[model samples]
Each structure stands twice: as C-alpha cells, then as structure tokens.
Target: MHSDVPILLINLDRSKQRLQSATEQLNQWRLPFTRISAVDGKSLDENTVKRVFDEDNARCRYPYDLTIGEIGCYLSHVKCWQYIVDHKLDFAVILEDDLCLNADTPKVLDQLRKITTEWDYIKLASPYKFRPYHIVEQLTQSNPTISLVRYRQKIPSGTVAQVISYRGAQRLLQQRPPFFRPIDVDIQWQHELTLDTFGLLPYIADNADAPSEIQQLATRKALKQRRWVKLKELLRFKLKI
Candidate 1:
C-alpha cells in the first residue's frame, strides 16, 4: 500500500559511513528512496546565523542555543518537507540516517497502507520515551499491531522514522526559514500542523546503535549551560522591583 510512497533519507554530506549503512538497509528491503544532502552548519556565514537566531521572531525556543549541528539537522528536515511539497507526493516516509528496523517493518508498513486514510501522520518509530494515549481503534483486532491513537499528554518527537501525508508536508512547509524550534518539537504542534497523528506500538523502527553525529559532540552539555544564561535573563525581565 505505502510501498510506492516515496522514501527520503536525510544524511549529512560528510557522514559516508552512516549513508552506507542506510543505503544497505534499504537495499535489503528493496525500498526505493532518495538520499538528501543535509545543510552543513559549519559552513554557514555570520549573516545566516543571525537570521536563524533573529531576536525579533524568537527563533529556536530551546532552553539552550542551538548547536551548529542541531541547526543543520533542522534545516535538513525542512528540505525534505519541501521536497514532499514540490513532488506532490500524497505520502512519504522520512527516515534519519541511523535507524534499526525489524522484520516486522514490512508487515507494519503494509498495515499502514490499509489505514492511511485514518491518519495524516503515523510514527512507525517510537520517538518519545513515553506518551499517554487512548486506543482510537484497532487496525486488525487480531494483534495490537497498527492502531489509531489519540496522544493525550504528548506530541511525537525524534525524526527517526515517520509517514507524512501531502497535507502534512504543506503544514510543515508553512514554517520556513529561521525555525522557532527543533524539527521534532515543532512538528508536535498539532494546532500548527492541523493533522491527525498516531503511533505504532513495539516500534517497527528504532534508532540505530550507530553514534549520533549531530549530538556526538558536546551539543547537549553546551546547551545545558546556555540554558542557565537564558534563565538568568528571563528572571531579570520578570523581576520589576
């Protein structure tokens, strides 16, 4: 069903090993997909950085300043969403460079095709650690397999693996340039996207064991310290005495 849907893999130009792994895995499944070259933040000029971090629009609401790698990652996703819109694909599967998929993936994908109309987006990979959900309906009653869910307490995170409909792509395309948040967090905004989102249990796709190039550096730790600086500024703004 979704077998024909275009699949796009986002990989950095320098990450050859990761690209090799992703390509090999797709070969095994005989899944046709396009590999996109990610934007290299290290190459960005001062003007671009200022634009991405504009003070006026409050781009990137993260507690910490976004690392160059993180910025690059976000831009890569934006490129993919734009590709979806440009190609006018009704639905497409977007996968990050590193992911582990089980044999059940094909089966789950087939099930997904059966229920595509029920959702605009479905997370085949469990991006969030935990999120509360109520079973909207069962895909096959036989097993907890593909099921429609209404996430009560959380929105999906992690750009590991997911299916996006054309409408979903349009919603994402609207949020262009100087992003206000990381790609995953921004996508979770249901009001912004206005789409039905669901998830799969016992994920067919999970992040791979390979090291994360984006966060492999001290990205998170630096962000943590940056958070303190931002917090102090916020306190000063609030205290009117």
Candidate 2:
C-alpha cells in the first residue's frame, strides 16, 4: 500500500517541464498523483493576497520580507494541506515538482504504511546535512536498514517531500492565518505548529538541482544576512558583560 496513499504534486502553471519530469518519475514508480496548480507570486490578486498573506506579521516575525516567490511556494504547500483536510484523507504524500525519486522509495513508503509509530509528519527529503537523530522505530522486522527518527539537535529544512496525516493537516491549518514564515521554516517551528514530526532515514528523494523557479532578488538575500550580523553583534556584547 504505498499506492493507496494519495500523492499531491505541487507544480506551477508555467513550469511545464518540471511537471513533466515529476509525472515521468511517478509513472515509473506506478504511483499516481494529482497536480496542484501552484500559486504564482508574480501575479497575485489583491483580494487573495489579503486573504492569505499577512505582510505585517511576516515582517515582524521573519528576519526579512519574504519574496513573492517564497509566498507563492508557501501557498502552494498550503493548498495540499487544505486538500488533505477537505477530502478527509488519513494521510497524503506531498511532493514538489523538482525531486528525483530513489529506487528504494516505493519499498520504503510501503514499509512506512505498516509502521506503528504515531506521527503527524515525516520528512522524506531533507536539505540539511546529517545531524544527530535517534532512531524511533524499525520499519520492518526483516529490514534493519530503514527506520523512523527524531532530530536530536538541528531540525532539517526543505519541503521537497513529506508525508502528512489528516491530524497533521488539521493542526497546520489551525494556524490563525496570514502565515509568516516560509513553508519549510513554519514546519520546523513545531513548538508553534504542535505536531509530532519525524524524518525517514535514509532519505528517499533528492533535489533535481534545477534552476529554481522561485526567484529571489539579491537585496532579499543581503537583508537576511544583515539580520544575522546584528544578532551576532548582540551575542558578542552580551558575552562582554
């Protein structure tokens, strides 16, 4: 049953090539999926923007103003979460369009279906390098190679691929909207989202490393770095006193 789990593929309307790549990969695995027309930050309607995004909150909470591309990407994931709730699905696999599937993915996904661990969210792909994590449960009695784990120190980032339960979807949606952080960052702040999150080891998908469709200007990058500098200076001053 991995095939039983619904897969939601987030693809922008203009990213036909990415859509094609994802479709081919899923077809190869014989895993069916539904395509979500991603929210395009380039041309957001005023009303929809007002309804979904909170600029003031984002500016206050996040280090820098979010690029429209980041906002659109976050909204795209939100669409998948909403789908899980509306359909009353028990669980769903959400995949971005730019992931390369591993041959072991299907087998790992099937084992995940049989595991007994109580989980709200599980990451299938992590952007960060390996960090300390404790194994939570062995996926199968026979194969000791794959297991579920909880991060001990640093939480991994990226929304490349993940599994979300119906309860998880509900908790995420419960956020009193006008969401502030990027989707990945918001998920990492489980203290706020309040979900029992975990990661599947070893990762079953990798980024395709294509030129990102989400565009951020140089100014935005510099602004984020500048915030870190200020924080570092504050830390230094505290150390002196």
Which candidate has the top score in TM-score? 2
Best by lDDT: 2
Weakest 10 consecutive residues of candidate 1 by summed lDDT = 53-62
**Which parts of model 2 have CA positions greater than 4 angstroms off?**
141-144, 214-241
Backbone Cα, N, C clashes tallied per candidate: 1, 0
Task: Assess candidate 1 and give its lDDT.
Answer: 0.70
Give TM-scores for every candidate, taking all chains together and pairing residue i with residue i. 0.82, 0.87
Tens digits of lDDT, candidate 2, 140-205:
655537889998744677778899999999988888357876777777677567889998877888
List of clashing residue pairs for candidate 1: 60-180
Q: Global lDDT of each model?
A: 0.70, 0.78
